[model samples]
Target: MPLKMDAAALNAFLDQAFEQVADDFVVEDVATDRLTVRLEVSDKHLRPGGTVSGPTMFALADVGAYLMTLARIGPQALAVTTNCAIDFMHKPAARTDLLGEVRLLKLGKQLSVCDVLIYSKGQEPPVARASLTYAIPPQ
Candidate 1:
């Protein structure tokens, strides 16, 4: 299916609907079943050990999946996370941004599921992985 929204449109929707965090995330790429998002790291995202915090990584995965869903389903601000599971495999590099690669596992009428892999910018191995299920509100 053709995309309902592209990277620029998704980014604009994020800015208009969620201004507080809009700048933190960048919708890097979008396709039929996948998306790439980047999280610009800052001091607020770091933990005591200087690695990216768990919550920060979770946000990256969650946001990546959410945006990927919206890209195909249109800008649905009410689309909510019904479930999420995250695995932190390795310590993310300090001072590096995080990148999330999201792939749609399922997209039905009422729900969309996605798998996300997060990596530290410039790193090869994934630092975290997540599976998310989102509830799409009826139009």
Candidate 2:
């Protein structure tokens, strides 16, 4: 599919949807092949050892994939995740920002696939990586 949405439009859509759903995440920046998203990690996002929680990382991956799909398909709000597999590679810092770098691997009529690599801000290595699949609802 051709590019139907730019970074600004994607950010606005995110603000209206997921951003409104929760204030912890913000769409920081996006490009034709990559998306930079940040999660304002807090105590609520942490697990027992002060590392970012798995669920939080999973949410980031999900939203990151959704944003990537919307960038190609335009503001199709009904597009939803159908499958996801996340790997927690390393522990993320406590109370720090988590940056998700998302790349859309495929976008078809009914399906979209993406890969997300998440890292804590100022950290050299990534904390998690995920592969996600989304179903694009027909209009």
Candidate 3:
């Protein structure tokens, strides 16, 4: 699929809504069929053991899938995450950025399902994976 919103446009749209959005997070790259989001590693995202917390990780997956859906379906700000299933496979390097690549698994009239893989930037394998579902408002 061709992208309606490019990396810059998508980032701008997200920035408009999430002013408090983490500086560590970025929509690094985007396409109609795929997107890459990054979380700039920061102290706010770390847990007691110096690892990224689950909530923080969830944010990455959520935003990644959320934006991909909006990118594909058009700017539907009303669209919200309905469900999220994430598995943390390993500890992320505190010094490296995290990346999330997401693709639409199912796009429906009222809902969208996305599969996301979160990786430590420059890593060959994902550090975590998530399947996110969003509820799209009626036209």
Candidate 4:
């Protein structure tokens, strides 16, 4: 299916629907098969070792999946994560933004499964990877 929302539309939707975290993430790119999101890292997102925290990475994955679903299905603010599996592979760079590259594995009427790879800006290898399933509310 073609995208129902683009980067600008998705960002606006985030601001209107989830104002609290709207500033933390930016929808960088929206394409037919993938969505790219950026997490603007701050001190609050860091851990003791000066690296991005696991929870921070997970949030990016979750939000990326949510936005990717919304891009195809239109703005569905009620869509919620039903399952998540994350792996922290490499430590992220300190004080660097993270990028989540999300791809939809399956997009059904009731659910969406997305795979996300998170990389610290300018890093070659992914710092973390996540698989997320979102439950789509009936329209």
Off by over 4 Å in 2: 19-22
Top lDDT model: 4
TM-score of predicted structure 1: 0.98
Candidate 1 contains a number of clashing pairs equal to: 0
Whole-structure CA lDDT of model 4: 0.96
RMSD of each: 0.6, 1.6, 1.4, 0.6
Structure candidate 3, residue pairs in collision: 24-40
Give the per-residue lDDT digits (tens) of candidate 2, residues 1-139: 5678776787778677766545776777776667888888878888898888899999999988988888888898899999999999988888788999999887789999999999999997999999999999996
- Model 4 lDDT tens row, 1-139: 9999999999999999999999999999999779999999999999998999999999999999999999999998899999999999999999999999999999999999999999999997999999999999998
Better of 2 and 4 by TM-score: 4
> Which is superior by TM-score, 3 or 4?
4
lDDT of 3 at 106: 84
Model 4 earns a TM-score of 0.98
Off by over 4 Å in 1: none
- The segments of candidate 4 whose C-alpha lies over 4 angstroms from its true place after superposition are none
lDDT of 3 by residue, 23-56 (tens): 5578878876788999888887888878778888
TM-score for each model = 0.98, 0.90, 0.93, 0.98
